[model samples]
Target: MPIIRLMLVFLVFKSVLSGVYGNNSNSENDSKVLQMLIDCGGSVTSLRNELQDMKDKLERLRSEAATDTYIRWGRSSCPSGATTVYDGFAAGSYYTHSGAAANHICLSKKPKFNYHYSNPYKSSYIYGAEYQTYESIWNNLHNHDVPCAVCHIPRSSVIMIPGTDDCPENFKEEYRGYLMSGHHSHTAATEFVCVDGHPVTAPYSSKTDKDGTMFYFVRAKCGSLKCLPYEEGKQITCAVCSYSP
Candidate 1:
């Protein structure tokens, strides 16, 4: 009976030891799980911050794109009742006499002096009474003149007294005034005479004469010349003017 009691006590001690080991193993496992969960939460937070940074960068780029500033003036057509007298194309915000930009003119299309002499001692001249396309005129000017009239024309005439008598001597009288063919018809369309040093929207003026003729004046600024609308694939250097009687 004593031997049986001792065996029972030994078995009870072994059982308690097994229970303690099992509890220790479970506690270690729970600690490992908690550590893994904390690590996963930290990684999630890092990913969210990275995503927010990327989003902020994308938003800044979008804002900058939205605020980008550049003005583009589409093709312009010549004034009514008149055809293109010149054509030109320039690049950049500014222009120069001898630089990246180009200036073009059509002097051949200008009015020609139709001499009329009542007597041998006296003479008269008739200028610009014919209707010609701006392209044809530009071709004529290009073929006839050297160095192109757009660049060679006097700057004083183009800038100081535009559409006035200060224009090139050959085309001065024809630059402005009434047509010999039609007493009521007149020519006051602004020409792209010279380039400005900077980029600017050309200044314009519109007026109606008592004769019901509408005049449009597109003045050049910022060292760049004014441009007019022309046929497809062609650039015309003339302003628009409309007249209705």
Candidate 2:
């Protein structure tokens, strides 16, 4: 217990003892009572320290739980030092649908369905994402269904940096790849994402033109956007980086 609380407890105990003893004082009895108080104080201090230690441990666990998570596109696994929350297929809206969502999603491999079927009418759909362009840097994973993994890293923040495959200083690179999104002239727009450098197809996947959400390699057109560090017709690279402070 705290020193102030311990002192209060000691004072209370002394008051109770004096009330009971009522001036029938003996030195031996007083010594025994003092020793008892010291023993009790030690026990209280030990218990308080243990409780404080447990509180510290719980705080650490909470910090770890509030982690950084991101989707590792074109890969079915997480990188080293990261935990795989789940491996799944990359899915998004059709590339030609003008009213569809602009961002992609990782569809869980093992999905749970509700007992009641809610929608019976026509609605928007999510289709499997595919790599539509071939690039030599990616080992030619063209026209293949993309696999994605949801990854988690404790006590960290992650970011995807475009234009260069290397991470910034003080940041650890999770994976590096080509930057991609829907084709420029497509009816539907899409947000750019970083595909894995060593891309892999989904399990039992084949090369087919099931034109869902497509990953077309991004290129730099550097007229207004910086031509010094970048050039036209050159494919842009991206790096997924994480920092733990």
TM-score of each: 0.23, 0.72
Residue 213, model 1: Cα distance from true site in angstroms:
12
Q: Write the per-residue lDDT of candidate 1 for residues 1-245, one digit (tens) a residue.
A: 24475456545644565577754545555555445555666787799999999999997775444321111111122222223434222112111112212212232323356568434674422111111112432222211111111222211122223333333432222123211111112333222332221112211211211121111123233223433322332321322121111
lDDT of 1 at 230: 21
The TM-score that candidate 2 achieves is: 0.72
lDDT of 2 at 148: 97
| Clash count, one per candidate | 15, 0
Task: Quantify all predictions' global Cα lDDT against the true fold.
Answer: 0.29, 0.86
lDDT of 2 at 97: 92
